[model samples]
Target: MPFSARLFCRPPRAARSRRSLSTRISAGVTALGLAAVTAPALVLLAPAPQAAALPNGLAATPPMGWNDWNSFGCNVTEQKVKSVADFMVTSGLAAAGYSYVDIDDCWMSGSRDSGGHLVPDPAKFPDGISGTAAYVHSKGLKLGIYESAGTKTCAGYPGSLGHEQADANSFASWGVDLLKYDNCNGDGTSPQQRDTTMRDALARTGRSILYSLCEWGQDNVWTWGAGVGNMWRTTGDINDSFGSMLSIFHANVQLAAYAGPGGWNDPDMLEVGNGGMSFTEDRSEFSLWAEMAAPLIAGNDLPGSSAATLSLLGNRDVIAVDQDSLGKQGTQISSAGGLDVLTKPLANGDRAVVLFNENAGAATISTTAAAVGLPASSGYTLNNLWSHVKTTSSGAISATVPGHGSVMYRVSTGSSTTTGTTHPLVGASSNRCLDAFNNQTAPGTKIEIWDCNGGANQQVTSTASGELRLYGGTQCLDATGGGTSTGTAVELWTCNGGANQQWRLNADGSVTGVQSGLCLDVTGGDQASGNVNGTALELWTCNGGANQQWRLG
Candidate 1:
């Protein structure tokens, strides 16, 4: 079995939560949170209201690059930022998609100008933000600035509190492409109000700058972050320590459903290459971020970073998963003895799994394909992400993970489907999800695959009872009255939790009825796409046919 926040930022006392995650979870994840923490509710509310989708399409994936916070902090200056920008380009981080060179708190003047607009501290930046932005752009990297939603930034710089529009206009005039808005000194402001104000102001500037909400998840920002910014910090500031990184990962992993194309749940900046962690721990940090589909913004001094750190930041395969078009976050499937299995479904029928050993010494971890949401009948092509080694395996995958280290694998099921935690179940061979037969709800309707869309007919779910439940209640994929023979019709029927309704996801990528001992297969073994998309599905022999391979991402 495998499965897996304390905020330490300096701030007003009330902004801190006494909660230290004292509960030691004995088992695995249940629902959206750990079993023990569910009663009090870890996340306070539902996602931001539907109307709050903001920032248009920028920061669609986790923003990747380097920020000055973890390394230089308030010591960041014009030369320092420019040097990092140069390193990003020279070290191939920019070419590898790490574009934003951001300056965190303390980059601004202590007070706004007499005109009530933000002004960069000339002593530090030398060139104003506009000129700095131009230099960054000339190097093919984006420029990011920091400010607070409150009256003052954490480092005592003038915040954007009362000058939202004016400051927004100034940033746009300076060609800023990213904004990391913090929440310190926000006297009477709700995270929502302040973030929303800036969001509106950014839009007014007519520049598509990526808005980052740094509220530290105090106000249930995910419930409304989409309405405010492209990515929102889901945790407090991260220290360059394994414990700190682990706490943040736990707090944000289960919030996957709240993340998608336009908005993301940020776990804060990367601490890799920083001196606080061993290289093994650093790899674990990078692996976890990629697993969460979180931003890969490196926080180390790029110039001083070792070659190993650069390689970790530039691993195109791990980056691919973080930047996958599907934009789904990975969830922990199991946890025990400090070993965790987290799975992220990819754009194709591929799955990325990380076996993280959090113990003080090395540990052996194993996870069955089904546990990672892979069908039992299908074989997977696996690539050890860190080693760049590829292999194939069926049944289950296992590894001896180093202490405080991780092994990540990108697995492709050969076929693809959209049936995911909230999306429809797609038949790998059919390129569609299992839908209600003829779009019917009554019992005994033929279940088939159709082009996935808003129609509830295509939606499916995997339940604890092992039923392929249709979106609507009362109906599920049934075995046509306990039939076990090949070619038995699989139809929609009242969900009675009967053996005929019980299905086991197999290694062969087929759903087998526990009672019938047969696999779910497309009629006539159709691997053909297009017009025959809505082909009927039935119970058939598990002969490892392409039509029997089903995947849910």
Candidate 2:
């Protein structure tokens, strides 16, 4: 997790030593040669059985809460934690969905008891950890405990290296609802192994603790974290700076393919209340994290937070996207001129889109429904997540975004088609319908006309890029063999996401390819039902003939 930049930050408590620069370089060269010999045969490990699922199906969506790491750090105590929980309720954070009050490092005594059980520092937590957990739970919030997989924590305190079961059982006895297992001072196991051990131990204790793997981003955690924990950090600790926040966002967004219901790519705790960033940057940070379906954990002091910080942290409209239940992380659709557009598909065919501008000042960014992967012919209703404003969208939406700020929208597709409907095409001349050949799905399947049967094979749906999908499959209406000739058959083929597959649904009911200036037509203006299937559909002149007239719902 933190082994790269943070591993050697301080020497081990008992392994004190130093080396000259030449000696260090010499050792590095030797280690490089050893690594070269062993790197290719890397051991691909899966989680070791016990950590496979949440104890009782927790974290169906990303976890939302407040942790003490960024704000209080080693200064965390029972009183401060209780105060934070009080603030969580009074400031409307708990009502807005925050539920956990986490204690970071330095809560344990320097030495374990004779029985080797961790002892809470009496100087800080006079009521002990169990008492603190009771206090937190009484305020209607859950408690999260922190531990390291190593022999000693980053702060040189007792860690859970050889005491996985003991620590897990103790946390369970203390009523821990979440466990943030960190990586420091190793006890000879790989990060994966270490994390899995604790997960298995948690299972043994019969507690439904939400496991959060905070090994930083080491060992490519996204690849295997789903089987190990509910969420895993995809970056090192985030500092209260624009660069740290942006870098973490970029790193986590690129690994979205590995995230889903049981697992997520964490970008560390929130820096919103830390006070180094402007309001615009703070809003962008939270908005983008929600867009990416990241865990919504606040790592700030809620007791003394300003109204701006509380507002940014407790915005439910933005939080809804993160907890959408579909759990699909947004993807970057396009980036240019310091603006980026991302889209995430939600349940029931709705989509959430974010237009972000990171330029020096406010800039106008615009995107068409097609660009963001919405059906081209249908109309959508757009709702701004931040402003709670709703409006109708014809085909495109544009807004002026302040620097380091974004405009978010939830778009419902196919709700505003003309005549308030969506159906298949019907040829006016032949009185037949365009259908996939024999309801077959394969390359070069010719699109022909048959009697309207109200079957799925005959239906057409517009795509975000203007492509008309064939038979609700990956195949799109294509120009046979990419032809530009006058008589090329309109056939179905696997969509290559190209201009040849894109079509424009003109208000005159003409379906024309964006690249080719040809119209979808019935061959030779055939009128007979039998002749409709016998003759092929072709690209022809854009005349308003009865053969060319069709219905597109």
Candidate 3:
């Protein structure tokens, strides 16, 4: 679906090369404790505060469903969609949380009726979309239709540009529960204005329609999209290829902060079972998509799909990560030479870690619990979602991943009293403590070096799971926007267990971020004479500088 032979005005997105970065599990056990310690009584923390949902009351979590574009494209028919809905229920996809049976572009006729109402192709949809919706509803599933905001859809069908109200009414009358509004041959107006028009029109119909904006990530939709639609595309269309899927993944993963409850940043539909990639690649795609908390709109042949495809799609553990109550999108903890680690914080205070390998051969990927943001414990449990294998580790989580494959683990602890130790991170050069600016705990509060005052804010805990927490494990030291480049600022934020929050105190006294592999440095304080108090902290190349050296007790 990434390309259409009869394409419209939309231009294809250029490909992007993967970032060069590597992962290091680090000798965290030595840094935390050189000797084996007794396990503490397990006591989990209360769930984190839930994110705000869109006022429209739809998609409190990312929507999971099926779209026909990637499979049948313009060949969609009422029978095909209805059969797919049936397959969704029988195949356990509906029970697994896939509800929408969407018919993308070309479902309508080439032109509108005299009354300006969009018409369904009689031959392909003899009973019309309403009839199909009725059948889908009887199966306890929702129906979704696609339309373009311009004069025509990608397949050259009539669009809803000037006929927003009429089209919305028709859809609402047809019992459509969701609408995928795309950008094709749009009017000269801005995408924001055009998309908002359809949004308001859908709302005016008095139906609880889930609006999906498919502008292909243009106009910075993620920034203002929560106010307009349930989910907005964060990239161009995806095809059933590893390269294409990987490109879209890179494009959408960095926009994690823009996605959560109510609205999400869509990275297009799933390409599993399409045969363009190997089974390993397909599983990797599913794992990465769930990790990112992106919508799991499967776009493949249901009846003809292999059992392995169905099993992968029905993996409840992975699906749970996608539907996690916290709605936090996972971020890259480390990636280099095709080996990547990503982690997402669950509502139950657990972390979901994915060891992904993009190389041509099997490779070993590693990280620590403290690096992934788990509370320090004598031991942690790792639940492999794909293999259904349960294992225990002191703090290290490592796996040999196949080429273009991934290993996802739900990392948690059995109740423990040894949560972690809190102490000051005193700069070896300045002899000052790393402090949160003004003792504030708000996200993005400045992280600076300050005089050692023994304030609670100065107490930093290097948890077994790799998080550097402040204020009794309430706020974490985070890399701004998960940037890996030099000079990325470090700040205080709620402990979301993201890779950016994971840090390592090396044997030589240098502190590095598990995600960026960059040393935690006092900005402009690379020399023996460190910067003055209130000097901000940033991630910089590891040079073994005095400012980058910290002593913890």
Candidate 4:
């Protein structure tokens, strides 16, 4: 069935209470009893908040807990689950809201009950799912189950391919509070079909369950994910290495527009506290996840976490971004080499900007009001989320991030008593640039750095209106007639405002032209400081090389 048509099938409501029929003699007795009953009247009522419609439309934030597949895979057992639950309460994880004890694939046996209901692996979960749910709930936690939308799950277990309603009803009856609906062996050709099938199943369950869609992003799930599930995996499974995490982190920037209240772009799960990455990289990963508004489902053994892991997990300021009511996902405002800057608007009108350095070598990343689409010369207060420090500045904000590290800040409008005069012509001094090298300037003339006199020659503007303009003039330093490729001379052209001339200054110091999608290259490929002007300029690959690195003063 079509997705829209299936969404209209609401769960059937429970039967209403009805008055009982009594014998004729009972009516006479009721008349005499009415006098006795008239002496007093009593009523009973239940005060429930309609299950509090899951936080972020899920059951909780900072989705505390673990997934077995990452560490133990299919070797999970009832004993191990119980031990983990015990440890959760004893190790203070439960208090921190890590309540869901989810069992991934392989917990299913090869058969169903006589009634055609899916059965748990009796050898592993001897007491069945109800017993497990009761045990987990007794510890002040909830139970989660995993299934696939295909004929077989990733671990080759039975999936709900054509049995959406049956599986949904079975889960609802099992007291499953969370469902990790995966896409493993389903028909890849039809995402709409897969989405409709799973959504219909969940909607008919008549129970409020946290639906985590794991279809990756093949079908632009971000656009239609909310109606199908509370959260959808924005990428494939991430490994426990820094490279994997970095790749996944950098990829989600494009999907930021789809994340908001009641829906999230899941970047798989947290690999922190899993003893995989260095302390620095692990912290960076945590901070990045929070800033990106990604779900924080810890995939490690919470019961066995070390002090460092606990500290990283307990950072309230970082958590605030993920739990922010605005639910805005961060997007890459600028990137050069492995360094990038991402920004997300917070509920308090403040913006959370994270400077990330993904390269092996150390690199500096800086951002100004103009680069981030904010007004230049405007005073702002920055509160570093990780360090919990406040910095006051006027004009621009810049920071140097270490290799494979990140610095996150909450920026807001505020008064700064300390104001310094900005350099007039030192656009380079301020880390701002007017034009690329050898950019066409009347053909014969080469692009050269001149004093910031606010003249036509010095003016550089961006495709985004009111953002990233040259220091002085309305004329923007543009790619010479929207030229593309090497030797294309950049020039101070009129702000026809074409996308080719439009540029985005990445947090990592790389400048990208909107139209050509190329980085600004220095002329003659010179990397030495103070390379004289009149050099041939052109576009080149962005490698954080010294030649491509330009500072905005």
Candidate 5:
């Protein structure tokens, strides 16, 4: 999250009249403060409530749909938006529950009308804002608009920096129901000033517009974003590829505590419809986002979506995870090389577990019921979201996850016997070398094996998979596969499930390939504490030395 610049100012006051107005204002403020203090401490102390009512007390989840900026950019037009809207209704997207039709950037002309108001580009939106909004509404969808906090938008168009009121009124008059407010050019001197400006503007609109603050996690927006807007983007702009998506998603795990209720921590829009990534990555992206409680705004040409895209987007069980009434965002409970276990509390008193393989090769991620914070001896009724299959278990749930894929299961208390065998070194362990591995690996690079000492470099975890992850739905790690020869580089690659991803820790503290049987040996047999890049590796004798021993905790 970015920090806002601070602004210092004194309150304006007139000598005599100022004294009277100041006293009244101070009293009102004091009274308000006292009222807040007098309220039940739970109401005040509890993290912000997630269940604030929306307009009309609507009980349904927010409608899902597509936006155009990501793929088409400044090329968005009325015909294009209308076609997408029509497609939403005709392609079964509307019936499947997506309802918002949004226009991103560069749709506006460089000037306002005679009324000193902003105007859409004549060629792009010939019928004007209201006309386009009506056309979208006619398609049984809501209309969404975009603006920047600075003087100019991403495309250098007019922004809402000093004209929040004007823009808010304009949006409301145009029948706009959603606003994607970007942080392009704002004098965000402080958190209070930046948030207050946007909040006050949205409140002034009178009409209940869903304010989406695109501030990219600045100022811990998730903690207080509900007071400012309906949702806030927690990361920078997202790309259409899986690596970018995973990178963004894994980076925001700590921010999960800030998301709930009417406010959410956005990981940016969906990249499902974009064709730059593999099909498995698309599925992983969808699954991870839903698991994280992210807004499901599609960013693609909806009119020409394929069946696979539709199937992925229209998965009801996955969508339910995203729209869980409990509004809790899932967090990373454990991770190891290119694999992760994420858990979220569901509305029905069950828990959703997503076992993700973030490496280039297939990998196994296992966890006992106790390790997942569940009762040791209790059975769990497991329902697979993707396959819609049911299974019963009492001890641990373990599965081999495909590279860049996930296994999503809804687990509830049940009566069943535990029947799974536990890996000798896998129950619960931690590794310090994992940190060294993450800090040293780069994209398209080789995973270098080195001598492990009891120092931070040698400790390994069997509890968590070793996959490095990004917050939200972004991907960042790349495991090219175990090398054919010793000293081959182990580097990070965009997540594509492949054999190169599998890593295992033997009981004697050695890390080996799950597929190749090659051990991860320290380069040059160097037991030196501060090993740097360009370190070479060769097959060496395993002596169960501290340098060779690793523990996963």
Candidate 6:
């Protein structure tokens, strides 16, 4: 339920296999691809190769922004780009985390300069890319430029194949923050080598640039992209059509395990505001992209976009899940007869569930909290992200999703872990209890220190499942992002029974995260500084300090 060639279009298919041997081979490849397409919920490819994450700290979450390819193609201009950047801020897109304004292709001159330096087309970009980038930066945004790995780009502009370092230098000098290195006009070399070459070249520039590989999923980019680029295209270009969007989703959804903090599996830029899809289909595209943790790069005419388009692009609550610090991409949990369910685990232990109906008519899709991996609870809170509607469910999560539409919810478990028995988790040095920010039961709410007032939000229950439940057992003290590193923020999230939510109450008055083995400490509060109310909690090295100690009674 879950869901090139030329213009990067392949040559017309050779005449269908005429010989028996050729027919068999053709059928075999078709069957393999069909399995991946139709059985998206369970199809698993052979394990991808293990690779280190790119050292670049950019894209700790999937990148959110806009690209010019899907809408403008080669008609991009500096004035159009500047206007979109202006709209990005004025329409609240930048505030909602859409930062990069990308120029897809054709921004370069038809030929390189006599000095061997790449040049922006003076006619298209009168002030040069550096000046345009300065203007974009002035508005608190970043600029992305596109190039190709081969001798020429998809549009036949000079590529970076033999000029990697020089082009990287030119880009860095122009203040480019992101590079969409495409797979057009390449030599016979492997994709990995070409992409990695650019990766190293970008590093040599000494600027933190996010590298995006547009290899069209050839060479199984996901297997090695983490070490080379921030995000790699897992499919061919996307068109402004429902059929095209659905096919891309099917191809990209099954590769979820390969995406994370430093690298993401890109399904290609979004076509949300394009005229081809209906409003419902557009919303479905946006929801599915966020659900899959794909980059939210808008590929529409932003300056001329309708109000509906702006609202869909600027939904912060939906964006939060895609940009969640956990960096886990959602996967299809169930798919049958065109009804699909996808679940993504958030940093605060909440699960984002999307019920999508791919059929021609609306249908009711159902799945339970337990099925989606939430801990058992007396009730579950379902916050409809698109509709902003709230509902309670004992366990089963169901909704009537419209045809070619999706209904997304931020689901949190509300069942008490224990039967009316709870105790306070008090800071050993501060003598203040752990409290949910503002007593809010929402996922991702900050966990802080507060006076021990016997409030339900401070009542903790050490459950058999290894979770320290609070908020009358609805919330858990979670290590943000499941991070095993020191200084990771601690928060109150819906109890999902994840390792990050598991804590050990040691005899030394310390509460240490089971995943990180780091003691919970009052942020910036030591014996000399004294812990105070509302101080945030974080995981720190276990140094036997009083600030790192806790008493659970």
lDDT of 6 by residue, 374-469 (tens): 988889888777544455789888876667878888999773322234678776456678888887988899999898898888888776667889
Clashes of each: 25, 5, 17, 22, 66, 10
lDDT of each: 0.74, 0.73, 0.78, 0.62, 0.61, 0.79
Superposition error at 399 for model 6 (Å): 0.9
**Candidate 1 Cα lDDT to native:** 0.74
What TM-score does candidate 6 reach? Answer: 0.70
TM-score of each: 0.68, 0.67, 0.67, 0.62, 0.64, 0.70
Model 4, residue 5: what's the lDDT?
12
Model 6: clashing residue pairs?
Answer: 1-335, 1-340, 4-8, 4-9, 5-8, 5-9, 5-10, 6-9, 150-185, 378-415
Residue 513 lDDT (model 2) = 69
Candidate closest to the true structure, highest lDDT: 6
By TM-score, highest first, what's the ranking? Answer: 6, 1, 3, 2, 5, 4
Off by over 4 Å in 1: 1-52, 376-378, 414-553
The deviation in Å at residue 452 for candidate 4 is 53
| Candidate 4 lDDT trough over 10 residues, lowest sum | 3-12
lDDT (Cα, tens digit) per residue for candidate 5, span 475-499: 3232334454554544545544455
Top candidate on TM-score is: 6
lDDT of 3: 0.78
Give lDDT tens digits, candidate 1, residues 245-358.
887787788688788878888888888878788666787898899999998889888888654466578778889989988888898888787699999988886789999988
